[model samples]
Each structure stands twice: as C-alpha cells, then as structure tokens.
Target: MKLFQKLGRMPIGLTIPAFAILLVVFGIPIVLLFLASINAPAFSATNYLGFFAQTANVRVLFQTIEVSVVATSICLIVGYPTAYLIVAASKSVRITLIALVIIPYLTSGLARTYAWIVILGDRGVINNLLLQLGVIHSPLQLIYNTMAVYIGMVHIMLPVMILPLVSAMMGIDRSLTAAARSMGARPLTAFWRVFFPLSLPGVRAGSLLVFVFCLGFYITPAALGGLRDAMLSTFIAAQVKNSFDISRIATSAFILLAIAVAVLFLLGLDLASAQGRTATTAWKSWVVRISKLDMLKRYFSRFSDSYRAKLWTTQLYQAGDDSRLSNIVGTMFVLLVMVYLHSPGLIVIIMSFSSGTFLEFPPSSISLQWYQTFFGDPSWRGAAWTSIQIGVAVAILSTIVGTLAAYGLNRTHPRLRSFLTMTILTPVTIPVIVVAIASYYGLVNLGLIGSRTGIVLAQSTGATGIVVVIVSATLANFDRTLERAAKSMRAGPLQTFWRVTLPLIRPGVIGGAVFAFLHSFDEVVITNLVSGYSIRTLPLKMWENIRNQIDPTIAAVSSLLMLVPVLWLIILYLTWWRSRLRDHRSRPELET
Candidate 1:
C-alpha cells in the first residue's frame, strides 16, 4: 500500500524520452542556428540589420505573407460552399464527394504542382488551345509569374480549408437551425446567425493553418514564380547556395519564425473556440472569457431579452432555400471547384500517355514508351528506390518516437499538457527552409550531411510532431478501465498495453505512420539541402528533370508516385472501419 501510494503521489514520467528527443534532436539545432545569426560576422547584430536594410529582401517577406493571405482567403471562399454541399447531400453523395476531396488530399503535391505548369506554361495546355483557336496571337505569359504561384498554392491548400469545415458542420446539431426557423428566422438568417457563428473556430483554425503553410511554401513558388516574384524561401535558398552566409540566412529564417510564433500565440488565445465538436468545457471557457470583457458583455446583452428578437433572412437565402435553381447552381459551382482542384493531376495522367517528346495537347499516337523508359532507365529506377527506402526508414522511426511521445504526453497532467504539447509540436510551425538550411550547416559541423542518417533525422523532426498530434487526439477520449482491470489481474504495463491499449489506438498510430511515410516521400527542400547532389529522392529527381530537361518521363514518374498514397488511403479507410467496429462492440461492454 505504501509503495503504491508513493507511486501515485509521484507523477507519471512517460514524457521523459520524448522531451529528451525534442531537446536534443530538435531544440539544440534550432538554437544553434539562431545563435549563428547573431554571432556570425564578428558577433554583432549587424547581420539582422543588413537583412532588413535591403528593400528587396523585405519586400519578399511581405509578398510571401500577402500571397499566403490571398491563397487562404480563396480557399475559404471556395471551401465553404463545397463543405456545405457535402453536408446537405444524401449519404451516398456525401461519401463520394468526401472521397473526391480526400483523393486530391492524398495525391502527391509535387505532381499536382508540376501539372499546373503543364496547364499554365507558355506551350502548356491552355495556351496551346487558345493559340490553335486563334484567340491570341502568341502564348500568354501565364507561368513564371505571381498569378501562377497563387493558383498553384490555392489548388494545394483547398482541402485543408474544406476538411475542417466538414468536420465542424457534421458535429453541429441541425436542430439549432431548425429552432431558429421555428422562431421565424429564414434559412439564410438561421445559418448566418446560428450555424456560421458556431463554425468560426473551425474557420479560424483552418485559416491559420493554411496561411502558415503557404508562408513556408518552397516548391510551388520555386517552380512557378519568376525572379521578381520570389518568396521568402527563395531568399533563404539563395543565401545558402550563393553566399555561404549563415548570419543572413538565419536572420531571414528568424523573421519567418517570429511571424509564425506571433500568429500561433495570438490564435492560441481562442484555440478551443475553433474545434468542430461542441465541447462543453470549450463553450463554458469561452463564455467566461466573453463575460470578463465589459465592452463585449455590454454589446452581447442586447440578445438577452427574448421579446426583442426578429426573424432576419437575406433575400438570396429566401429565394434559394428549397429551390431547384439553388440546387442546380450550387451543384454546378461545387463541381467546377472540384474540377479546378483536381484537373492538374488528371491532365498529367493524360499527357503521360502521349507519344510526343515535346508537350503536345493531344497525342497523334499513344504508347507506353515513357513508362518503359522510367523502368528501364537506371537513374530514374535508382532515385525511386532511394525515396522508398528513406520514406520507410523515416516512417518507422517517426512512428516509434511519435507513438511514445503521444502516449507519454496523453498520460501527463493537464496543467503541463499545453507547454509540453507546444514543445513537441514546435517543428510544425518552423519553416522547412529554415530546417533545411540549419540541417545543412549543423550536419556539416557533425559530418552527417549527405548521409542517410542526417536526412532521416531532419525529416523525422517534422514527421514525429505530426504523428504525436494524430495519436494524442485519438487518445483524448480513450477509456482507462481496461488497463486497470488488466493490472488487477497481474498483467504488467507493457503486456496490458499490447493486449488492451494498442489494439484500441492502433488506427491513429497506423494513420500517423502512413502520413509520416508520405511526408518523407513527397518532401523536397530538406532532401535537397541535406541529401546534397550525391543522393536523390523521387521528388528531387522530378524537380531536377523539370528544371533542367523538361520531359514526359517526369509525368510518368509523377503518375506512379501519386498512386502510392491512394493505396495508403485505402489502408487508412479500412483501419477506420475496424476502429469503428471495435468501438461499437465495446459500447455494451462499457455499459454493463
């Protein structure tokens, strides 16, 4: 009893290994990198000054932010209607629409970006059609411009906006809208007044996520934009390749990092307000916060009286609700958005089969020549093998570390949970360009750059964070009684975990591993810097081929790369089904 009491009195120490990993693998390198900024160039702060002193450099940072905001806004505008349509659809239609959204989500981002180039470039699909039709005298300057970057970015980010909204909308009780209707509010008014307000948390969270991700975007901007339109990643890359100046590179990175941290901190203030589920605690906390603000409370007090409420409905909602015109228009709009998001990859698939060495919109003939060459060519085959090995290694290592981190953090006290969660999840916010640059310098010092170990370690830094988030989220509502029962029967912790806990949480664990695999496999910037020229992954190969040679072989490679994740998505769906079945079977056992 005394020993058990002592054990109970002390906190669970499961987080030790995870904390150590973050501190050593993640924390030390970033700190050293940041320190390099201040200490380089004879230990003065002038490097940072020099960075800001250049108007061109400062413009790049602001332009990056502007483009990110624009992309995020476009995503939201396009996503909301799609999400709403998904919610309003019949079960079969809803499932199909969701699968459509998810297919693109799972597809290779590099392939999609590359496809946009095919569609938007000088000799690309759109221009070729227009020129043949005599619509223009010459090919439009579409690719290698700011517009190209934004379009490519919005295409990639649309799913992020929609998924969160779908989850939020699904979690909402339609009764709230019905209640508003019962009280004489029109459909549009009810949506705006009730459903929309409730979905703000999802909106806020999605916007922040999309915006931050856009700011760090290297691949799309690098591929699509011209010299004048370069993003922050361009500056970071230039400094790395040309200048060999750690101080300036790190300072630029520091600025990007600072912006991300500030946004994250601001958003953290109302984090609970954005979750899809109507968490009682979240609402209560939010209520308390609002009540504390005198001005807000005073403004809200107008709604306290029941008699003063009026049925408010917009003219558009009044005309559209239950109307044939609305359904047709909405369906058409949704389809268009879906096609816009999905067309690039589809276009690539079609072109890959074309017989022409140069890009021809429609092939006069068809052949498997490119596919044959892809398999027969040694360099392509070697790169593919390298990507697979690295992806597998990162996935395995990330899953182990991330699962441990999630389990440890999940068992921890709520008071310390937020801090520790931030520490573990810090990698997600830090720019990848920054990580790549730092990894290059830091690994060089340790003589690990260009080695498999260096690439794996660097890539795992981000992947592990993602896995921890996925697993920890699933563990939030997990039942602990089974573990206690097994303990009562003299089963050790590891045995109990294997027999009871792991079985239940395996869905999240597997999902995280699949995602981690995809992360390393699709990754390019970090792989470019850390792997150096000696090692090349499929994405790196594709990028090099596109930039240097510009051939149809890349299209063949991209098509195959896109297929792998679809298979993983199938596995994820099966795991989800199994998880649901287990939960269903366990309900009665718990009730008893």
Candidate 2:
C-alpha cells in the first residue's frame, strides 16, 4: 500500500492487470518475433540481406511507398474540405456529418472491398452505364490496375484523414478570418492567410496516419489489384505462404515495423502527443515564419494599394454571392464524396436482392434468392457464427482490459502515463501485417495455431487501445467531486469505482465494446495469417469467394455484414440523443 501511494496513488490493481494482458499477448509476441529475426541459427544478417538484395523486393518497396503517398495525398485533398464543411455546419448538421463519415469507417472492410468489386468489375456499374450510353461497344477494364487500387485505397482511408482534420479545425477561431478581412484582406486572402495555415497540423498528422495505413494495405489491393500491382504487404503474404523460413519471415516483419515507427518519428508525431496540440504548435510556428518571408511580401506588394482597393470593391472581386455559391458547391462536392464512399455498399445491397448468379449491375428479376442462398449454405453459416463468437469474446476482453488501463493511466503521474500510453498504442502504430506475422509465429509457440482462441487473442491486441483512448477521454471530462463524496461517505476503492466511476463512464465502455467487436468482425490481415480452413471468419470467407466466384450470395453476405455496424451506430445515436434530451429537460428544473 505504501509503495502504491509512492507511485502517486495510481490504481496499481487495475493498471497492472491491463499491462500484463498486453505485455503477455501483444508485447511479448512482437519481442519474440524480433528476437527470431536476430537470433537465427548463425545469428547474422544473412536472412535480411538475402531477402532485400533481390531486385523484385526493392521494386515492391518503392511501389508500396509510391502507392501510399498517392493515396495519402488524395485523402488530404478530399478530407480537408469535408472537415471544414463539417466544422462550419450547425450543431445537428455537424453530428449528422460526423455520423456520415464514421458509418463507412466502422463498416466491415471486407464487405467494403467486395462492394468495390461490384462497381469496378468489367460488367460493373461504370461499364454498364457507358455501354448503355453507346459510348463503348465492349466493357472497359477498370479493376486490376493502378487507378482502381488508388480509388479503393482513398475511399477506405478518407474518413481516417477527415477525423483528425476535424479535431484540428475545431480549435481554430472563426473570428480570426473576420479579423483578417477587417484589416483590408479579401475573403480568399483572409482564408488563405488565416484559416489554411492553422489547419496544417491536421493536414500533416492525417497524411502521416493515412500513409502508414496504406503502406500495410492488403485486402482492397488484393481484391482489385493485379499481380503487377502487388505492394510490400502482398509480397510479405506471398513469402509467408511459400516458405516457413522463420528468420526470413521475421526479418520482413521487422522491416515493416521499423518503417512504420520511422514514419511516426519522421513526422514528429509521438504517441504522447496524440492530442495534436504539440504537433499543431510545432507546424503552426514553422508556417508562421514562412508567412513573414520576403517572397510573400514581394508578391503581395506587386499590387498597388489603390488598384487593390478598387479590385476588391469590383463585382467580380466582391465576396457575397460568390462566397455563398462556392460554399454551396463545396457542400455538394462533399455530399458527392459521401455518395462515392458509400456507392459500393449500396450497390451490394441492391445486388443482394437480385435473383441472379453474377453480380449483375441491374438484375433481370428482383427476389430474395441470394439471401436464401446465404442462409442455406452451411459453410457461410459456420463462418459467420465463428466471426460473431470471436468478435464478442474480443469485445468483452478488450473492454475489461482497456477500461482498467484508461482509469489507471488517468490517475497516474504524467511521465508514467505517457510511457504507458505509448506502450498501449504501439500495437496500433505498427502495421497490421507485421502484427499478423508476429501473431503467426507467437501462436505457433503457444500451440494455438489455427484455433479460434488465436484469432480473438490477435484481434484484442489491435483493438484494446481504442477502448483505452475512448474511456480515457471520458475520464478526462468526469466530475471528480462525486468520487470524493463517495470516499467521504466511507466508500471503499472498489465500491467507489463500481457505484460511481463505472456508471459515469459507461458510455465510453459501450463505445469501446462496439469498436472492439467491429475490429474483430472486420479484421482480415491477421485472420488470414492465423486462421485455418476450418476456422474461417466472414471476412476470410469473402476473401476466398472473391478470388474466383462472382456470385450474388457473397454480395448478400456483404450487404448483411454492412448492417451490423449501422445498427450499432444507430443505437449509439439514439442513446446520445435521449441523453441530450434528458439533460435539456432537466435544465429548467435546475434553474428553478
């Protein structure tokens, strides 16, 4: 007890268990995998040199970087404006906008990638439309190319880019732009000078995250990309399958992990600064210096003062109707982007109801035949049940461990908290493909290979930090006075936590659970590595189906899988709305 108090009265009981769980499950596996890389039979760089010296390996590395950069650039170009519109909207509209972005974010990634198949296939929507318009006599090759890969990557990654941007944009004061305008700056000038510079931190941060994610991308690229389009992840997967050369596999896995970590360092994005304030300050200061440059001064000075004033007052230069129209267009563009993001899932939904064999653009007849096929197939049914069972177990385990870690971290000292937080988020920062490799080798040692338990264990490692972050945010806003009051009434630590703290942060717990389940259900990279034929999840099943089969049954499964996240989101929305309503209703009573 004295030792615990010396540690700044941290929740050691809660903290240690969570740490132990992650250490044993996540931390140890990565360490073992890393050791395997260096601790070979001869203990040399033979494996790594032999692997990387190949011309093919070097080309794939460059290709992966090129693809990642292109995808990240596209996400920033698209997400920045959408985030601006979201921040500028009314309260209700803002919530709706966020929901719109997050729905696709939470939906099953496999189902989502499958939706792309329906749209980008030769007889898919684009080809069918062009054929009908008499623009083409034959179907065009959309998928199995570089352009298709970029589109799929950007679509899946846009929400990730927007989320951080929203956070960064929300911090900037709108009055700053008005202040700039009042100082004789034009509307575009004010926005460019004031707004755009402040949002750079978000831009940089989002770009880093999106690029890292795209680097390790597998599912979408696998579905739509040809063999020539294969990235490092695809290369790694191929290597894993063809050879059980432990040192070689570990070397490849470690290389990917090192690259991911190096990215975070190069971007100066420490996990300790996940809140973005430090990153914002760093970039904001740098941009501020550039604004004072002679080049900018000379350019602005090019326009004479009187001419500038006259130009600003002209009909073409005035910013009333033009600004409103631009805003309207911008909002419409965002709406179109949302439609583009959701087009695949919507296409899948329609195709699921069709009475057809192919994933036809327009079904000759509309019926429930595909749905019936999904229900009747024993293989599909078993895969889905295994996914559900594994997902639930992952959710429960992650929540328990994450809640403890969050509560403990919140109560600990800043230095200790930062270190612990870094450890927790380490799993998230590393590429999933790397983690999958580690998992495969680690599970082999534990004799859990090809087991459902292995699947859950691997997924929980990736998901637990999400819960920690969410619950930690909740705790940040919690009223500590209530806990003190309970303590003053002679409540024990356990009693205070159970009766007071738990109730207050139940929403965060629920959010964490939902995310955990979603992560487990949609996860494929790790599942592909750890699972056997008998232990296939819904995503693994879909992955196999997409390789050769082009049937409505898979579309039906994709459509149904999309509904789970939607249902979870709807429940969260309703609960939040009801709470807001109740809070509003009670305000008048409190005033009286």
Candidate 3:
C-alpha cells in the first residue's frame, strides 16, 4: 500500500512506459542502423562510398534535395501572404479561413494525392474540359511528371506551412505594426520593418517542417512523378524492395537522415524556442537582434526613395478614403488559394459518384456504384478491417502512454521538460522514412515483423509523440489550482488526478486519441517498410491499386476518406465547446 502511494506521487514514473516503448521500437534500432551504415565491427564507409560512386545514386540524391527545396519554397511563397491575410481579417472571418486550410491539412495525404491524379491525368478534368471546348485536339500529357510531383507536394504541404506561420503571427501584437505606421512608415514599410522580422521564427519552422517532410515523401512523388523525377525516398524504397544489401540500404537511409539533420542544424530550429520569445530575455540578445535588423534595413534602403514615397502616398490616400479595393483584392487572393488547396479533394469527391465505368468530372449519371463496389470486394473489406484494428490499437496504446507522459512532463522542471519533450517528439519530427527504416530494423530483431502487432507498435511510436504534443498544449492552459484544491481536501495523487485533473484534460485526451487513430489509419510509408509483405492495411491496398491504376473504386475510397477530416473537425469543435461551456458554468460569478 505504501509502495503504491509512493509510486503514484512520483510524476517522472509516469513517463517510463512511453519511453520504454520508444526505446524498444525506435531508439535502439536507429543505433543499429547507424552501425550497419558504417559496416559495424569492421567499421568502414565502403557502402557509402559505393553509393556515391554510382551516377544514378548521385543524381537521385541531388534531385531529392532540389525537389524538397523547390516544394518548400513554393509553399512558403504562397503560405506567407495567405497567412497574413488570414491574420489581418476579422475574428470570425479569420476562423473560417483557418478552418478552410485545416480541412485539407487533416485530410489523408493519400486521398489528396489521388485527387491530384484524377485532375491531372491524361484524360483528367483539365484535359477533358479543354478537349470539349475545342482548345485541344487531344489529351495533353499532364500527370507523371516533375510538375505534377510539385503540384501534389505543394498541395499537401501548404497547410503545414500556413498553420505554423499563422500561429507565430497570431502571437505578435497588432499594436506593433500600428505603432510602426504611426511613425511615418507605409503599410509595406511597416510590414517589412516590424511585422516580417517578428515572423521569421515561423518562416524557419514552417520551412524546416515542409523541407524535412518532403525529403521523406514516398507516395506523392512516385504516384505523380515520372521515372526520371524520383526522389531519394523513392530510391531508398526501391533498394529495399530489389535488394537485401543491409549496408547499402542503411547507408541510403542515413544519408537522407543526415541531410535533414544538417538542414535542421543549419536553420538552428529550436522547437522549444519556436513558440515565441519572452520579454524577460537578456539585453545582449536584443542588441544582437537589433544589429541584424539594421543590416536588413540598409539592404531595403538601397531601393529607390521615389518608389517608397509613391507607395507611402498611395497607402495614405487609400487609408484616408477607406478604400475597399485593397480589401477585395486580399479577400480574392485568399479565396483563390483556398480553392487551389481544396479543388483536388472536391474533384475526387465528385468523380467518386460517376456512374460511368471510368472516372470523369461530369458524370453521365450519379450513382453509388463505386462505393458499392468498394464494399462488395472482399479484399478491400479485409484490408480496411485490418486497418481499423491497427488504428484502434494504436489509438488506445498511444493515448494511455502519451497522456501519462504529457502529465509527467507538465510537472517537470522547464529545462528538463523541454529536453524530454524534444526527445519524445523525435519520431514525428524527423523524416518518416528514417523512422520507418529504424522501426523495420527494430521489429525484425524482435521477430515481430509481418504481424499486426508490429504495425500497431510501429505506428504507436509516432502516434504517441503526436498525443504528447496535443495533450501538452492542453496542459499548458490548465489551471493547476484545481488539482491542488482537490489534494488539499485529503485527496491523494491518484484520487486528485482521477477526480480533478482528468475532467479538465478529457478533451485533449480524446483529441489525441482521434488524431492517433488518423495517424495510424493514413500512415503508408512506415506501414510499407514494417509490414514485410505479409499484411496489407487499407492504405497499402489503396497504394497498390493506385500504383497499378487497376480500379476506379479507389476514387470512392478517397472520397470517403476525405470525410474523416470533417468528422475530426466536428468532434474537436464539440469537445472544445463543451470544455468552454463547462468552464463557464463553473465560473458563473465571472460570467455574471
């Protein structure tokens, strides 16, 4: 009884389960992978040398970097202004626009990629519309090219870039920009001199996130890109499939990982500091920051004063007149970006109902035939069932483990918490391919590969990380006095948590569970490496059919999968609303 009481009182013990699983599934195997890469025991770089010696390997490596860079650049270029407009809008309008971006973000990447194929295929919407309008005599080559690869990648990654920027920008005080404008700065000048610099952390974070994710892209590049446009991930997957040379495969995986780590290091991305800076920072830090700002000011000052003067006068005229033209343009630009983000999913949903034998935008007749086909196929049903089982297992496992970890970390010292949080988040933060390779190697050693248990454990490693993040965010906002008050009433640690803390954090726990399920359900890259060809999850089946173009029934699957995000949004909104309602009820005096 005393031991139980003592154990319950220790917060650090709560994290042990999560850490143990992560170590078993990811940490140890990654060490093994590194050792394999260097030809352990004999310890040499022969495998790496052989990799670089090959012309094809060299081309693919450079090409992977180029594609990732270009895609991230496009996302940033588009996401920055879009996020600005979103932040600049009215509160209600801003929420609506953010929702628009998030709907696609939460949607499955595979479904979105399929949407791209349907729109850009040779006989796809674009070519069909053009042909019918007599604009072209024949279908144009659109899909299976480098451009299609970028389109799919940018579409999938834009929300990632925009969300981080929006978060960072939202934390900035609007009064700073207003103050700059009052000091004779034009709108452009205010944004440049004041707003833009404040948002650099967001830029760094969003770019790094997009760049790292793109480096590990497997499905988008393969399904949409031509043979010559293969990324390093595709190359690595091919090697895994075609050969059993562990050293060669390990070397490739580590090289891809090295580039991601190098970029992370170069950008100096500190996840702990990325949230925003506090006013309590040292004066020296501010001085160094100001010097950097001065350099930027000088560079911008090089442009003509005439252009600046004209822009300042035009802005003053517009402000005095309260012109709606600029507002309209900003709104229009936002609408167009939303459309670009959503069009592919919309196209896929519409095509799923086509009664014709093949997918087309304007169906000859609307029918549920494709959905019926999907349900009727035993193979499809089996795969979906397998996925459901794995997803549920991952959700339950991750939620229990992650919530405890988050709770423990919440009570830890700040410095230690930040370090542990980063360590916990490693599975999700790095390239998915590297995690997959490590998980694969780990499962093989454990003799768990090719089993549903392996898939669940493999997915739960990342899912648990996501859960920790979400739950930690909720804990950040939680008032600890409630728990203290409960404890003061003679409640023990377990009793206080069960009776007081649990109710307050229930929404976050639920959200984490839902997200964990989605993470497992949509995961393919990791599932592919670890499943060992002995099991087929729904995504694996979908990916197979997609690669072969064997069935139009996948359109129906993609359409249905798109609804998952909508459902997630509804669940989250309700949970949040209920949380707020409960808080309001408890603080009726404040409400009055």
In terms of TM-score, the best-performing candidate is 3
Q: Give candidate 1's TM-score.
A: 0.88
Candidate 3 local lDDT, residue 60:
97
Clashing pairs in 1: 201-274
Candidate 1 regions off by >4 Å?
Answer: 1-12, 40-44, 273-322, 578-592
Q: Kindly give the number of clashing pairs for every candidate.
A: 1, 0, 0
TM-score: model 3 vs. ground truth: 0.93
Give per-residue CA lDDT, model 1, range 474-523, as digits (tens): 89978989789988999766777789889989999999999999999999
Q: Pick out the ten consecutive residues of candidate 1 with the lowest summed lDDT.
A: 3-12
RMSD of every prediction: 5.2, 3.1, 3.6
Q: TM-score order of candidates, best first?
A: 3, 2, 1
- Which of candidates 1 and 2 reaches a greater TM-score? 2
Model 3 whole-model lDDT (C-alpha atoms) = 0.90
Q: 190-256 in candidate 3: lDDT tens per residue?
A: 8876788778778888999999999999999999999999988888888888986778888999999
Report how far residue 237 has shifted in candidate 3, in Å. Answer: 1.0
Per-residue error at 402 for model 3, in Å?
Answer: 0.4
List per-prediction Cα lDDT, in the order shown.
0.82, 0.83, 0.90
Q: Estimate each model's TM-score.
A: 0.88, 0.92, 0.93
